[model samples]
Target: MTLADTLKGMIGLDPTAHADADMKAVLAALKELNPKPIEECSVAEAREQPTPADAVRKLMTQAGHAARLPLEVEAVQSEDTVIPGAAGSNPARIYRPAGDGPFPLILYFHGGGWVIADLDVYDATPRSIAAQSNAIVVSAHYRQAPEHKLPAAHEDAFAAWRWIVESAASLGGDPSRIAVMGESAGANLAINVAIHARDSGLRAPLHQALIYPVASNNIVSISYEENRSAKPLNKKMMLWFVQNVINDEGDLKSPLIDVVSADLSNLPPTVVVTAGIDPLRSDGEKLAEKLRDAGVAVEHRNYQGATHEFFGMAPVVQAARDAQTFVSLAQRQAFGGVPLEEAP
Candidate 1:
């Protein structure tokens, strides 16, 4: 079978399967594809079976193997930089493209609901975007929810963008060519950051790329109801994340919590991607309509036969790569030409 077919088979397993057996099969798949075996696997095997989260992480690691990512790209050097925010510190990795004077910049947030994923976890996707898009990538490591709470992640995200704008010249990125991009909850953060930027009268992002973002405050979208138990990301996990992020139900209606409810006028050009079987699909589609109605240039596409988190699982499927390519191209066009001192 093709790699995609194999991936479909593996991820298609019942989510309610025995955790141990499921993890074993997932580990075996990773072993087949050659993974950086974690020592915890042996430790966990000797103890009580892995949790569902553990199983999902293992599956995601295997999906990394299934991605069509160009494994060998000229490495863009990165350094950890701390950016000041409203709440506290937001750490970011500054990716400088090769031969760059001042490349266009992309501020990336990772998807892990609002809690789980981190900058290192989503490293490959950003690297691919940097290499293919030929732009500097600043991956934001925002504070997770439950620990940071609602508006904390959002505050840090906006602060990271502000810091990028303030320090762009020093970091070899065009301040005028700043774009915001994220996946899943990160995508949610990205859209909300644009909302903040627009409302605050600060210069908005030149472009925004949200890959199947969580855009609704309400959890009644068709995809949410249909794919509630889908693998990689599920309804319970999503609600859990959302609950942890927001303090009260009242916060849910706040424009900060739901960009779909916010005024989308005067926003930047947007490329919104939605997955066929993702619960968050309708939110993105709705957000796309709002942006267009507000006169923002928008290109929205839904990838059929894919699930949530497909954008970051580049190792498993071509759909992920294709989406990245599309987003990168859109960013390039939206930013026009990078007026850097050197070529990126």
Candidate 2:
């Protein structure tokens, strides 16, 4: 088996056939670049207040161009669904989905290095996932960094999750069938939510879907060194984002920011998706290993050729579709046993 194929076998998960060409191409491309180690990267910077509207506009514009997937999923938009949040901040958002009878819900955190993302910009992608998984997807608008640091995003994540658990019924969702999902920095938040749920005495999600997650700000993993300059989500951008998100070195060491070394014993079933060409690939792999070692039911998928943020590019890539299928199946299997599955 090729290296990617070998890794899949090691984890007891299957590789999607669509990733074949992409994986091969990416591996070849990386060999040509001869990337530097993650340690060579600089520390992430602190966040600062700027006109965020311009940043949001640019990202949404890029997403619009990036979104080539046809609108095949039925969807609805919601605004300002409140959740108890940290001091002076009440997290809220827009939700989207199809079907009416208590669907599985996804409490989604958006990626913008944890400093720039917003609901309106990421609405379509969550809407797609919700439709594909038949889940009610809530796009959480959390406190951005530079102003809010490590614990702030973690706090908002927990609050939103609690809100979903308590108010799932009103949103036409089954409280027992919720999942937490995100990409890049948001993926880190989703993983944090899962960890917190298991440790905080709160209701745990049925599943956790992490798309090219950032499990550490350290960037010491093999993939980080190998794909430091990988397009879309590079190591520099990652370091910059982390620097902005953490309050200081101590905060950087917090379990919420450093998931790789964090205790994984209580996390729920998880599906971690990585791109063969992405720097964060090793983060996802290592997390899956840690979770499995901790006796959690975890599945890892590495899509070749696709690159970072492939999950959001479902509009044009077959790999993204296959991933959605895999996650949907996993979500159903996880919730199938809950007593609430039979509730009204």
Candidate 3:
């Protein structure tokens, strides 16, 4: 049996019947790439591991699809730039759909557990969001772990938020109508950005789209126990990420890291997304619960048969399309703009 099948079999989960067919294909492709486990690799080795996005691209290319999915997913204007960070400067990418007037801005973050992956690895989601949500999307990259551990990324997130807020207008976006977005660990950064803004009396994000966020330091929750062997993102991988980023056991309790234990009061309206076959599913669900309990407006959507990092694979996954629409509609309403029509 293949490594993917062997792993799934060992966990008593049937890949073919457990996840969506399309999602299964992507997972299989990723497994076929045969990267070392995050727990078993050096930081450099981990960074080089084939990602879910790569799997999506490979499938698209092999299927005789059009180009590498920036425009294939949705047509939007894109540019690369640099932004100031808590440490040295970091890189950023901006996505704008066809338009004349300034559009609503979304300061975004890509997920790699604060270690691997960069702006290029996460191009699909922001590009799609720009068109469907009628907003300009600015995706940011921060310092990574094993080199720049916890709070390094957090500080950079705040710096990126500060930069985006001031420069939105210059980029053909409305500074007054702004939001924040991210996937997985990046979502953790996004919410912390909002909390930082509220505490510092800075401009607030109208909404936050948190896709499969790393909400808590709790890695042994029910969902974690269940999807501990799920592909692309299992409990072991999540633990590896935490281990690399934190300096000590105490770091796990920091509000910035254990966001579920942080203050959720007065944060923006939130969209918490969860994948049925993900270790962080509990993270997303728990954060949503805490947000609502803290009196923030919450819209939580859990897609069964989907996996972590599926948010950006809409070009190959139907759940992704539905999620894109769900997030777009939510953001449109929050920005007080006209309703966003379905993506063409």
lDDT of 3 by residue, 43-93 (tens): 888988888888988888775442344453356889999999998899999
Off by over 4 Å in 2: 1-72, 75-80, 89-91, 337-344
Task: Provide C-alpha RMSD values for all models, in order.
Answer: 8.1, 7.9, 4.3
- Candidate 3: list runs displaced more than 4 Å: 1-16, 64-74, 339-344
**TM-score ranking from best to worst?**
3, 1, 2
The number of clashing residue pairs in model 2 is: 8
TM-score of each: 0.79, 0.76, 0.92
Residue 339 local lDDT, model 3: 48
Give the distance in Å from residue 102's predicted Cα in candidate 1 to where it truly belongs. 1.1
lDDT per residue (tens digit) for residues 1-344 in model 1: 87545544544344324323332344345345443222222322312333322433556555433323363344667777777877777777777667746788888998876766566667766777887677889998888766778888888888887888888888888788889999888988898888888888787899899989888876766666666666455666677677777888898898776777888888888999997767788889999998899999899988766666666545445676678777878887777753222324
Evaluate residue 258 in candidate 1 and report its C-alpha lDDT on the 0 to 100 scale. 79
Model 1 global lDDT (CA atoms, 0 to 1): 0.72
Ranking by lDDT: 3, 1, 2
Q: Write the per-residue lDDT of candidate 2 for residues 185-304, one digit (tens) a residue.
A: 888889888888878888888788888888865675667666665654566767777777787778777778778889888788788888886778988888888889999887888877
Residue 83, model 2: Cα distance from true site in angstroms: 3.1
What local distance difference test score does each model get? Answer: 0.72, 0.69, 0.88
